[model samples]
Target: MYVYLSKIVPLFLMPLGLIIFAAVLVLLLLVTGRRRLAAWLLSFTVLLLWLAAMPIVAGSLYGRLESRFPPEPLARIPVSSCIVVLGGAVGLPFAPRQDIELTEAVDRVYKAVQLYREGKANRVFVAAGNQPRSESGPSEAALIGELLVEWGVPADAIQLEGRSRNTRENAVNIKPMLEATGCDRSLLVTSAAHMQRALASFKEVGLYAYPVSTDVRAIRRTEYTAMDFLPDAHALAMTSDAIREWMGQKVYQWNGWN
Candidate 1:
């Protein structure tokens, strides 16, 4: 139920969705002869859109999330502990290619491999499942495992937990696997923005996962340029992601899943 709702709810909360909603409301008010209300709604919507596109606003929102957990150096991660890499790093393949395609969160997989090569962890676990509407193909975990093998990690050193569909499910499903392997502690690899919720979910399931955040989105700017204040679609997208993480944390807490 949570998984299904999560996938659906975000569509209505993001910037595009909010803009559409506001537009519809304004149309309704104008049709009802409430011109004053319509004008107010239009202005509010435009202001929101402008704010959402500002780089400074996007950076600050994303920074709050990505900074929740500082990146852990590979050398400092416990040696021989299991390294668990969460999903959201890969997209479903559109067509067969020579290699699997990775998304912005590819840092999760690469960091996991680096942990293994540095001898910080003897085993790497890729926790991801097939996309909900995806057609036949290996799951995300399997695809990442293949990449690990290509990167010189032993095939036997990698484990696949490809049944989880979200962070909560990832924790619930991976618990049994960890227990079976006597892995009481693990190095958790995921996007820096998602680490807070991921850590909370794992804790709820009784796993003490040491955070090794990846794919950090927040950046510190030493000087602001003219372009810094310009409206950017990418900034809006980043803001949406940060808002989603914030909401995820709140919802997880409310449901006692974290």
Candidate 2:
């Protein structure tokens, strides 16, 4: 239920959603002979959209979330009992594509494989499952497990907790398995922007996880070009992602899962 709500509610609260809502309201007001109020609302909505699409504003907003957890250097990564790799790094296989499609967060899979090869963790625990309760395709964890085996990690060394649909479910479902395997401490691999909430969720479930942040989106320098001030679609998307994470954190806290 929480997963469904998170997916639906955010569409009405994010920048683009709010702009669309305002535009529709403005149209309604204008049709009702409320030109003065409609004009003001339309102007405000346009200005808000412009600001949200600027690279400088979006970068700063995303930076704050990504910077909450720094990536652990490969050489300095601590050894742990297991490596827990969360899902959302791959797209489910669809028609015309027989293989699992990797997404921006594929770094999570690569980092987990690297840790296993480096002997940082004796086993890899993949926490993911199919959505819509699919019965025909492999779960995300199963595909990741296959990838690990192809990369030379023994099949026996990989564990699949393929029943979780979200971060909180991942923590709740994986904790018991980890405990059963005597793996109280594990390296948690996920995107840098999502690390804080993921960590908090695991901690709330009484699991001790060392963060191995991947797919960092924060800029390191203060340098900016003229184009940075201009409106961009990519910038707007990044801002939306940041806003979603912020809302996710708040929701997780409220649910006592973080």
Question: Model 2's lDDT to the true fold?
Answer: 0.90
RMSD of each: 1.5, 1.5
How would you encode candidate 2's per-residue C-alpha lDDT over 1-258 as one tens digit per residue? Answer: 766788889989999999999999999999999999999999999999999999999989999988878886788988899999999888878778888898888888998989998999999999988776453578889888887788788999999988888899999999989999999889999999999999999999899999999998757766888899899998999999999999999999998888
What shift in Å separates residue 228 of candidate 1 from its native position after superposition? 1.8
> Against the true structure, what is each candidate's TM-score?
0.95, 0.95
Identify the leading candidate in terms of lDDT.
2
**Model 2: how far is 130 from its true place, Å?**
2.7
lDDT of 1 by residue, 1-258 (tens): 667788789879988799999999999999999999999999999999988988999999999888778787666777756999998887766666656788999988889888988888798888998757763777898888888898888999888999888899899999999999988889999998899899999998899998999898879888888787888999999988888888888888999988
